[model samples]
Target: MLVILVALLWFTTVEASHCSIMARLSLMRNISELSQNNYGRPDLSHTTIVGSVLHGIKEIEVWLQNFAPGSSTPIHRHSCEEVFVIVKGQGTLYLTPSSHSKYPGNPQEFHIFPNSTFYVPVNDAHQVYSLP
Candidate 1:
């Protein structure tokens, strides 16, 4: 059986002008129901839940990600701090805190289960793998 791992990603960085005074609501949809994009990685697929393109959210961007069993994301780093909320299944996070160094050193592994949360510092290289 394929264990689908669902996660919500909060990206902290947005333009102020895109902020809105009125409140907005975005309903969460099923993983298979929502549009999924691999983002250049075959093992990972993600859909934007809230952001400038969808809700004009200026403070943060929200995304829903689904990972197939035995799949893993590529080692990557970003400018903004990222937080992940795991809703189902389990995974392992490999993080390398080398924001100030020229090369990413050995990574530290952390196991993540359902209902758990993890944070990644800005520019820290990291990868997540779905456990079967």
Candidate 2:
């Protein structure tokens, strides 16, 4: 009788552990599905990211952004080359040539849509604005 009782208790404990693991796996799957479906969610811009320096050879990051009409970035130069992938709306890019300073040329407006990207060379001074 004592041996039979011990065996039943052991079986129940093992089954409970398996149930808990399965529950955790189901939660993880749901999170992954939500991320895939909501890649362009508006809420993404509200989250702030603290800056940190990376020590490795390569680093990658993804960001979602929304620019209000007439919004602009200050003229700045980048030490590293930069790329901007437009996910929506129309905007303007101000690119300066080597011979000119103080925003060099007239603003170039681009009608960029989803799935488009542009690259700027290093040391290029530029500013960007969204048309109202």
Candidate 3:
């Protein structure tokens, strides 16, 4: 199983005219203590730490994702970049850079370990799988 800390920043044309001067702090808790959901994917669950749903932060979303052995996220893409900070366990990232292509091409595989960090470019197809 693997536990990954994902920090996703959304780019938008709308700018924050007034930034909050007040700072916010989030206390880290046990993964089981935080609210989590699979979003319909089996063996994979995620807890949102900072995002529009919780902290009302419009520009960024932080999540803690847990994957059981042999589990993976669906092949997906987003308009905004997605970054991952590996906290524990090992996994493989399948990435296909197809920003301009009509269909996704072959994917490049990358191995990830603890303490490593990686980012997915905007609109690229990617999937993450946890090794048993």
Candidate 4:
């Protein structure tokens, strides 16, 4: 009985490992193919970063959004951390904590310029606006 139980567990573990390996291979293949495809179009407003995501890693979505004189992203939360970098004009970030705070729902503003990168923690609701 001991031998049989051990054999079953061993086979299950081996099979699971094999499956994971195969999944990783497939993901790598897909990411490679997508990288070869045309990701977006050129525009004066903003451009998208081509192939921003890698297969098997879905924690974050990367984009290069160009705002007109005034543009912004919607307020929302991510399952994982979200990050942004300013590749162009000046912008402002507005953040409000989802919990109680000493400021009591006051908004904090960050002035961002070209080549600045910022990270927002997961589950924090926030918004962004571009300035002329």
Candidate 5:
């Protein structure tokens, strides 16, 4: 899975570079540039991510997200499929949302541990709840 993800990431970077000059010329990042977080959901701690955007890439955006214990995402969906790779810690992935709702109903859930990869289907509601 990790190998496949890497290949996909590389393939996407190359594919997206066709859209812009910066993306074509600057395609890498260093550890020093990352920030600690993303934004907010509801009752959870602040969502954090360390991401260097090859900003303006077509069809792909990648970020390294971290979740402190007890942090979680509100159930949500995206027009495009979203992937999550658990680089560290443990969590529960909620899946198969019951309706066309953005965040609704009892859905199936799975426990996730480090190095795991999963994706929310296009338009399917899903969330990841960090474990203590």
Candidate 6:
């Protein structure tokens, strides 16, 4: 299991009996039914994002991305750390030392297979390149 500490967000509410402050979410989520969003890069036409907001995941966010062969995303960074899981297919994971435009110089590559899990640190630039 890939557990990520994307970020710590604190939510406060006024004391009220109408709401169960300790209520937690315990339900099954279907990937097929989840909404998918496109990546920022237009060339990443082969990539789609499956994202959602869950009840118990207050301080964290979770989602899945689908990549087709030859699909690649531009080097990018996020304020929060990212977690990746190769649930299916094969791909190449790319990492660079810098987040600048000329970054990814001397980039590191990794072979990604199904059931594999990887992570990118906060503000660390990285990209994914899909393979056949």
Compared with the true structure, all predictions reach lDDT values of 0.70, 0.44, 0.82, 0.48, 0.56, 0.55
Ten residues in sequence with the least summed lDDT for candidate 2 = 1-10
The most accurate candidate by TM-score is 3
By descending TM-score, how would the candidates be arranged? 3, 1, 5, 6, 4, 2
Runs in model 1 with CA error above 4 Å?
Answer: 1-34, 39-43
Query: What tens digits encode model 4's per-residue C-alpha lDDT throughout 1-132?
Result: 000000000112122343444465553233223322223422223322322132223222344455555656677655455666566677788877652344537667888777777766655667777675
Q: Which window of 10 residues has the lowest lDDT sum in candidate 4? A: 1-10
Off by over 4 Å in 5: 1-26, 40-54, 97-105
Error of 6 at 118 (Å): 1.1
lDDT of 1 at 111: 89
TM-score, one value per model: 0.70, 0.48, 0.78, 0.53, 0.64, 0.59
Model 6 agreement with the true structure over 1-132: per-residue lDDT tens digits: 111112222232423332242254225656466554555643332212211233433444455555557776577877666777667777787876555555546768888777787887666678777785
RMSD of each: 4.6, 19.9, 4.2, 15.1, 6.7, 7.1
What residue runs in model 3 are displaced by over 4 Å at the alpha carbon?
11-32, 40-42
Which candidate, 4 or 6, would have the higher lDDT against the true structure?
A: 6
> In candidate 5, residue 98 scores what lDDT?
45
Task: Give per-residue lDDT, candidate 4, residue 104.
Answer: 38
Predicted structure 1: lDDT: 0.70
Q: At residue 48, give the lDDT of candidate 1.
A: 70
Candidate 3 per-residue C-alpha lDDT over 1-132 given as tens digits, one digit per residue, 9 for 90 to 100: 889999888654454333341234354546567788898887987898765534546788889999999998888998888999999999999999975588767999999899999999998989999997
Full ranking by lDDT:
3, 1, 5, 6, 4, 2
Q: Which of the two, 1 or 4, has more lDDT?
A: 1
- How displaced is residue 95 in candidate 3, in Å? 0.4
lDDT for each residue of candidate 1 in 25-99, tens digit (9 for 90 to 100): 344546356666777877676777655545555556667777888887788887777888887888899999976
Candidate 4 ranges beyond 4 A from true positions: 1-60, 98-104
Model 6 clashing residue pairs (backbone): none
